[model samples]
Target: MIRSERNPAGDPSGPTHERVFRALRTRIMHGEIIPGQAMTIRGIALEFNVSMTPAREAVRRLTAEGALSMSKTGR
Candidate 1:
């Protein structure tokens, strides 16, 4: 989801990675993310308007938390 500048969810007042992580985590827990859905770090970065670093970190964290499952192909 593209965070809009006028949206409160896009507060832009904290660490980018944390914000991205929280947003994604909430989605996962709330069943917004479907089973077997796949996305790339690059796609995350682009969608969230963040740099690769933050997006990678967020994905890594979610993977570690079991909120996201990584495939052998690293999807």
Candidate 2:
């Protein structure tokens, strides 16, 4: 039951990661991100200001949905 100022977006519903993942998913599904866009964990991490873990999970979920294709070389 602790209140914090971390929610500058005024979204008191939940954490920011979920919103980021949703945006990421939409972008990927709509061809905004593009396949073979060379998205690194660090790049995504930086892009969304999320740690490697959540970013990784988001990517994994996207991969599972077949919206994103992962290659061996990360290219």
Q: Which candidate is the best by TM-score?
A: 1
Q: Give a tens-digit lDDT track for model 2, residues 1-74.
A: 54333342466645555655788888876889976788886788788776776677777777788877778875
C-alpha RMSD of candidate 2? 3.9
- Taking all chains together, the TM-score of candidate 2 against the true structure is 0.70
Query: After superposition, which runs of candidate 1 have C-alpha atoms over 4 Å from their true positions?
Result: 1-12
How many steric clashes between backbone atoms does each model show? Answer: 0, 0
Q: lDDT (0-100) at residue 60 of candidate 1? A: 95
lDDT, residue 9, candidate 1: 59
Candidate 1 per-residue lDDT, tens place, 1-75, comes to 766433435575677888889989999889998879998889988998877888889999999988888888878
Query: What local distance difference test score does each model get?
Result: 0.83, 0.70
